[model samples]
Target: MKLNIQQETAQDFNAVFELNKLAFGQENEPKLVELLRKSSAFIPELSLVAWFQNQIVGHILFTKIKIVNNENDTESLALAPMAVLPEFQQKGIGGQLVNSGIEEAKELGYKSIIVLGHEHYYPKFGFEPAEKWNIKSPYDVPANVFMALELTPNGLENTSGLVVYPKEFDTV
Candidate 1:
């Protein structure tokens, strides 16, 4: 299917919300998206949607997160709650959203991205165990499920710490 990936607009809000719920078969992801939108962490350019036949079929969000260390804190992006309509699964819509989001993030000068997701899936996008950089997720999750991707060369080099997600994430 031909899909157009672009930054989501205000008019796409309702559609994106529904898409998230339908894709995940739950309300958590949709609620997360809404909360992130209102937080200081939201990255407008990285909040993207996949459209097909004028309807939104997929969505992806990248939010600002802090990697706190003893010496200093580094700002990085976090990919969370990406979703695509049920009928759209396995059709590359999700991949497109991910790829587009990553490209846009790099253009915006983001150095790294962290994702808590399927162990088998995210690796295709160059995501590796964040533990390799001594980066840890705030929540206790298996190491492989929490991964990071460096957008710039050695972006995570010497960066060791815990990822601090926005407060809004606490509810979900």
Candidate 2:
């Protein structure tokens, strides 16, 4: 399928919200997206959507996050919640969103991206266990699912600490 993946605009807000709600079968993720859009960590360029013909079929977001240790606090991007229309799932729309988002984050100079997602799916895009870099998640999750991807060589090198997510994520 030919997809038009682009940065989300103000007019796409409600469509994006409904996309997440329907994709995830809940309200928390959609709510989180709204809250993140208003938070300091929000990056307009990283909130992307996939348009199939004219309607939104997929959505992805990457927001600023921090890795804090006693010594240093490093900035990174977090891929919190990615979703595609339920009918559109497993047809590569979600993968297209991921690949597009990665390129966008790299172009914008983000070093690495953190994600808490499926252990198997993300690895195809080069994501690995965050434990590979000593990074820890704020919640209790299996090491394999909480993954990180270095957009550049050694992007997470020497970056280790607890990921500090925006307070908006607590709503999830």
Top candidate when judged by lDDT against the true structure? 2
> On residues 38-132, what C-alpha lDDT tens digit does candidate 1 reach at each position?
99999889899998987899999999999998899999999987999998899888888889999999999999999999999989999999999
lDDT of each: 0.93, 0.95
Error of 1 at 70 (Å): 1.1
Structure candidate 1, residue pairs in collision: none
lDDT of 2 by residue, 1-172 (tens): 7999999999999999999999989999999999999999999999999999989999999999999998999999999789999999989999999999999999999999999999989999999999999999999999999999999999999999999999999877
Per-candidate RMSD vs. true structure?
0.8, 0.6
Error of 1 at 130 (Å): 0.4
Clashing pairs in 2: none
